[model samples]
Target: MVRIACLILALILPALVAADVADVYDFSDRAQEQRYRNLIAELRCPKCQNQNIADSNAPISKDMRDVVYRMMNDGASNEEIVESLVGRFGEFVRYKPEFDSRTFLLWATPAIAVFGGLLVVAGVVIRSRRSGSESPALSAEEKARVDKMLADQDRPS
Candidate 1:
């Protein structure tokens, strides 16, 4: 009887787990609900870099989803909603960052780093070729000494 009770409890335990998802939308129109899903998928969870608000377990993500749901219910446009979030959290909260003078560095930094690496590689290759092509100069006395050593070596075993 004790084993059967434990097995029943084990089977029922999974039913108690709750994800903090917002109430399912009962929008008069279907498109608005779709838009809400898309918007939540686009917004990054602040506490979790790799997860969107829809998929994140963080309370912040749940709160952000609630905000998005409320904004959609209030008839806010997608752009307006996104702008509100960006205004509060800066551009980092959005998966797609907007282009502006301030973000030029963010977009250009990787290309600049690649170009800098290529220049360094080219400089190293050029320097190595230059070094390898230069023959060491020998004094006449040094050449004579080298020749003498060769001659001695060749004379007998």
Candidate 2:
């Protein structure tokens, strides 16, 4: 039946696609495999900001995975692998960015904004307190008019 064929196709497609994964690289040891996993998890997929290379099915992510595997197999250090990728892809490749002069603003922006907001609020509060303590003096004519109005209001209806 067409329905049976469609269901079978749906089930088999994922396995066929998963067959294309970066598992082609053979690790000599469990530690090497774990390091490869960690590197892939830490690297972001260029096409998808929220997904790491390990979880992304994007072509770029697959390529990144391949590169990481190859680098690890060649006995490259983690920092060396990361730095090389960072050179090619920019610092956005890492989920946790390294701190440097260029990245200091990225890390500190939120705190700076909060501090600026608090300063603004303090200014407003200071203004309110200053304004509340005294009112502007009325002119003599206006004072006389207000006194007359009060006197009229106080009289028996």
Give the best candidate by lDDT.
Answer: 2
- List the candidate 2 regions with Cα displacement exceeding 4 Å: 1-25, 135-157
In the range 88-118, model 1's lDDT, one tens digit per residue, is 8778888878878988998899999999999
In model 1, residue pairs whose N, Cα or C atoms come closer than 3 Å (at least 3 residues apart or on different chains), thus clashing, are none
Tell me, by TM-score, which candidate is best: 2
Residue-level lDDT tens digits of model 2 in 1-157: 9999999999999999878634467788898889898999999888997899989989888888888888887889999999999999988898889888999999999999999999999999999999999899999999999999999999999
Q: TM-score of each candidate?
A: 0.68, 0.70
Full-model lDDT, candidate 1: 0.87
Task: State in Å the error of residue 64, model 1.
Answer: 2.4
Q: Model 2: how far is 11 from its true place, Å?
A: 12
Task: Give me the overall lDDT of model 2.
Answer: 0.90
Compared with the true structure, model 2 gives a TM-score of 0.70
TM-score result, candidate 1: 0.68
